[model samples]
Target: MSERKPQVLLIGFGGVGTIVSYTLEHLGRAEVTVVSRPETYDSIKSGYRIESCSYGIIDNYIATNVVKSTKEGYEKYGPFDYIIITTKNIPEISPVVDFLEDCYHESSTIVLIENGIGIEIPIYRKYPKAIILSGVSLIGTTLYEDTVKHIARDIIKFGAFINYNLDKQMQYDRCKHFLSLYSNDNNFAEYEENVKLTRWRKLVYNTCINTTCALTDLDFGRMDLFGGMESVVRPAMKEVVAVAKSEGVEIEDHVIDEMIRGEDGVYYPPSMLIDVRNGNYIENTVIISNVVKYAKRNGVPIPTLTVLDNLLKLVQLRTGEAKGRFELPEKRPLPEENYQIQFKY
Candidate 1:
């Protein structure tokens, strides 16, 4: 009998998603499909045009199937072996539960290839029997006209949720099966044991530098030139370290210091900053405000993160949900954010 290829479905086909799709399909390891917004659905159906110096450019790669919604996707091509989420960690607009209603099966693993802490809580609550996993993508990628420029090393730290008390061997088997789908030379994917600590480590950089870049409308390069890391980034990084330490994840002083400061005159804008420049809604709640809440519950104060969170909240009030069909509050007390970016959250 011929070996049956593992079937995989990937949701949130953004820059990161595109990178994974091509890598998986090119490997011929899994049957890949993408569930994306309707507007880009047709174009993605046409095929993803990909370009990366590290992994030669390919035009009109029709390797993966593309569909519009999770309902349509599950109806047509699921009970997939794996469903990976590559979108930003924003649960307010579309709760993770919405995607699982008609698609999830206990045997199938759900992989969240995004950032932020506390993301697993909701998924675990809703699908207690399902296998849940997460990844911290260490790549610098930006989308342009169906093309993704992968400028940084494409390394990903993936781990299954052991907090659910699933058999360790079972989880490892599932993780290995999912990890085998990618074969890109540039994409170095690995299994991680300390999932919570890993997420917090990344958060040290994100909650500090990413938040500052978004609030100031500057990229990493610009932020470096203006002494923003010293003036703004350090205090926030230290505050986040405090929160992480409260949660038993000891973030050393040098760890936060090494993360937030980058080489001067580098032009990489973190994802949140990119969202703001494009006049789109940033992942304000997940990366910033939510972390602040986590701090409060643990009795750790994050005054700087709080300030950054409030500032981005104001910025989004003006930037139209530029992504596509993402809606904003209609009747609100706050003025259009274009007035003046105030440090009040």
Candidate 2:
């Protein structure tokens, strides 16, 4: 008899999701069942043509199974060994915990491959018994229509989210086993003993550079053109480092410079900017507000992050209200326009 491959259920079908699904199946180590929306279900079910810089061209790829909703996936492929979530971490519209309620089992090992800081707290709180592996992925993959373009680096650091309720050794073993599944020459995967520190390090880039680029409507190269690196970017990163230190995670001072230098000449658009462009709500809570929370707890003054947080809240409010994600407020008529002076250029 042939060896039984591990059964996996992956949620989300965006750029990151596509790459993960392809990688999992490429080695034939796991049989993946994907959960995607009904709108793009057919297109994804047909196949994905991936153009990865690391893995080269992989034509006409599809998962072992594709389902529309998490409930459906659970009913069809219930009690999966591993459940990986690579969706946008937007809690207002949909919480990651809600998805788990539908498919979670006692033995399932959950893996989070999303962005933002402190994202694992809620999950760990809810599923205290289950082993949760936190993943910090450093890849630049974009899904446009049908094709997935893997643009930049492909590296992921995995570590177990500390759960006091579970055995530490068991958590470590599960995390290591899960990490082993993604072992391939095309991508880099490693175990991080202090993954939270890894997360804080990434936040130095996400909280500062990603948020700044989104708010200013510019890419990395353009942000550099405006001297943002010296003025706002570096200072904001320093603030992030301070916040991380407050949380007991000591991020190196040189990481700020390294992060800035990483995007020196690249014109890449950060995820927050892409969300703004797509009219989707930015990840304000996890990316910024959570850090602000930490800073306030430790009495660390983060004036730059506070200002950025307020601005991002306004942006999120506008986007959320437009999308009807929030309760509609009482509608009122606008005040009469005052006399306006016309100016000729």
Candidate 3:
């Protein structure tokens, strides 16, 4: 028998998926198959386009196959080596969980490249056979009918949550498989060890920037100049740091604060803000309520987080969206402030 070429199935053919598809195609390592709703599939098959503001050109991408949501989406294009998901977390994750159950397998790896905190464990509980990876993306994409406007240089950080230390070669092989999709451009992917901290750190930054920008209806550039935003931002960061500490993870306040300032302090609108602008479901429960729960558990008072959580709840209530499906997790009290601000190297 002839050797088989590597294959990848991309879920959520929205902004991020388009970028991944563009990069993977340019790299030319694996055959890409996109699984999206029917309308998105038609657009990709007919000819999907990407116009990059920074990169300076509109390019068209054609995938090997396009199928709407069905077992056929997986059955026809799978036994895929990797499934890269960029979908948002909503409705307590029922739809995505069902999708994963239908599509996940031991031979396939699922990489979550989306927003929010505290989502991976539930996925693991449901799909233990598949290798799960969590990632943080710092790229921006705007949609424009059968095309996405790639707004910034792609900065993707990803890593797996492996249970045991596998042999070096096995680990390297898995890493290599992932890197292949972005090999043509080394700027897109980085393998990180402190992946959980990385994810939480990014979330903390987003929670501040996205919510603030959305509320103020301003972009990051102007928002950065606004006075007293730090009062809200710093307090939220403290809650995030406290939660990380409770989980035995140490994250510096300055690191989180600086992270809130994006690349060159670029005035980009965050995903949450984008969702609110689009009138879509927001991640109030995961991002806001979780912080409140953790702070209450640690005996650390998060006055600002409570306020923000209440504000988010008001937004949901006024919009008549899904409210509080996730039960508040048990609280873990934080120790007294005996820590010094250790400078990050």
For each candidate in turn, the TM-score is 0.88, 0.93, 0.82
Which numbered prediction scores highest in TM-score against the true structure? 2
Which has the greatest lDDT? 2
lDDT, model 1: 0.77
Deviation from truth (RMSD, Å), model 2: 5.7
lDDT of 3 by residue, 103-169 (tens): 6667887777777666665666676545667667888786778878887778877777653434444
- On a 0 to 1 TM-score scale, where does candidate 2 land against the true structure? 0.93
Model 2 C-alpha lDDT per residue in residues 46-107, reported as the tens digit of each score: 99999999889989888899999878988998889999999888776578888898889987
Models, CA RMSD each: 4.7, 5.7, 9.5
Compared with the true structure, what per-residue lDDT tens digits does model 1 show for residues 1-345? 979777788887777887777777776778787887878877788776777756777777764577787778788988888888888776765666567777787767998887788887888888777787778888767677677776666789888876455777788777776776763556788878777788889988888888899888898888877899888888888888888888888877888666765644467888888777777667777777778988889988777888888887767666534444445455553665544323232
Q: What are the Cα lDDT values of the candidates?
A: 0.77, 0.87, 0.68
Any runs in candidate 1 off by more than 4 Å, and if so which? Answer: 320-345
Model 1 C-alpha RMSD to native? 4.7
Cα deviation of 26 in candidate 2 (Å)? 1.1
